[model samples]
Target: MKDGWIVNRAGLINFWYYDDEVFEFMDGRLLIRGANGSGKSVTMQSFIPLLLDGNKSPERLDPFGSRARKLEDYLLGEEALSQTNERTGYIYMEFKKQNTKNYLTIGMGLRARRGQPMDSWGFTLLDGRRVG
Candidate 1:
């Protein structure tokens, strides 16, 4: 979604270690609330492998953001899924940078399949005059 952070969905893995469920993300943030061992930590751990090599740390406890896992699960589809949930929707994120009093928008809308690899896609920049 962005350079330093990402926003996406929550992925679910079946008892067999296969991803079987995905919670569609409407907003970029999620508040995981459930009893202990209800998959909150596991959901967070799923994002670790996506960070830059050194960005990952063994001491880190929870990766509670939507980006990595959602992207991973989408890009790595069926291969990552024992069963896919077609009802799932796309997870979208936009990276922002603060400049003085304004915020500048950077990357946007990175999509991935339930169990496939992250998609390599880019956006087109529009000219200011005629495109309105």
Candidate 2:
């Protein structure tokens, strides 16, 4: 970790929709410019999942009581699971560690049953590689 070890980009694959979306941090800021109901809040929420510690009380994460109880819940949606294929969705984040020579990629794969919690999600951390 370094001073410039910050999130530079993010991607979501079939987490909410069947398509994939990617975003890049520009000018050292992430600006979600969109109209209402355009997933601004959801996109913003996606950035915090990796930093969350589920073992701790979720009071800070769910202070509003109606936001989200878990990180997967934030990513889960009505059609989060794929109906046409066996592939589950995933969320990816890229961080520029220290300098430009090395980077860190953190990924969270999500899978859920119709009436069950999304406890099947997987988290992975890769060093010195970039995954997109």
Candidate 3:
């Protein structure tokens, strides 16, 4: 039998929420139900850049190149920024590849500065205590 690929955990900080919130996925389908502007799309689309190879910009993420115009476009707002927090925003996902014996975690962080053209961002991958 082929191994199962499941999203073990996922979360974001400052992208949609001022604080961090994590989601643990069990063995089943995930259904995100919510009202308008409930951050449903924000939570689902948060993984696109982490799972796939990209510059983590809105235009790159948009295949049609018609949706987002800049990286700051995804930033929740100036209110989401904080002097206490080192990172302006970030998204992370942890999962096990099919049939694989190892667990992988990937994440991306954003830093936006006022009046700057673009936000400074970086990506990370972690397996156990090792980092890449």
Q: State TM-scores per candidate.
A: 0.30, 0.67, 0.65
Residue range 7-119, candidate 3, lDDT tens digits: 66776776645367777766524677899878776666666653456456565554455554455655634434533322387777767655565566777777766466545
Write one digit per residue (lDDT tens) for candidate 1, span 1-132: 233333344333321143345544433566768897676665555443422122222234234543333333332444444354332222212222222122222222234455344343323223211111
Candidate 3: TM-score?
Answer: 0.65
Quote model 2's TM-score.
0.67
The lDDT for every candidate, in the order shown, is 0.36, 0.58, 0.60
**Best model number under TM-score:** 2
Pairs of residues clashing in candidate 3: none
Query: Which candidate, 2 or 3, has the higher TM-score?
Result: 2
Clashes of each: 11, 0, 0
The segments of candidate 3 whose C-alpha lies over 4 angstroms from its true place after superposition are: 1-5, 49-51, 59-69, 76-87, 97-101, 119-121, 129-132
Which of the two, 1 or 3, has more TM-score? 3
Q: Which candidate leads in lDDT? A: 3
Worst 10 residues of 3 by lDDT: 78-87
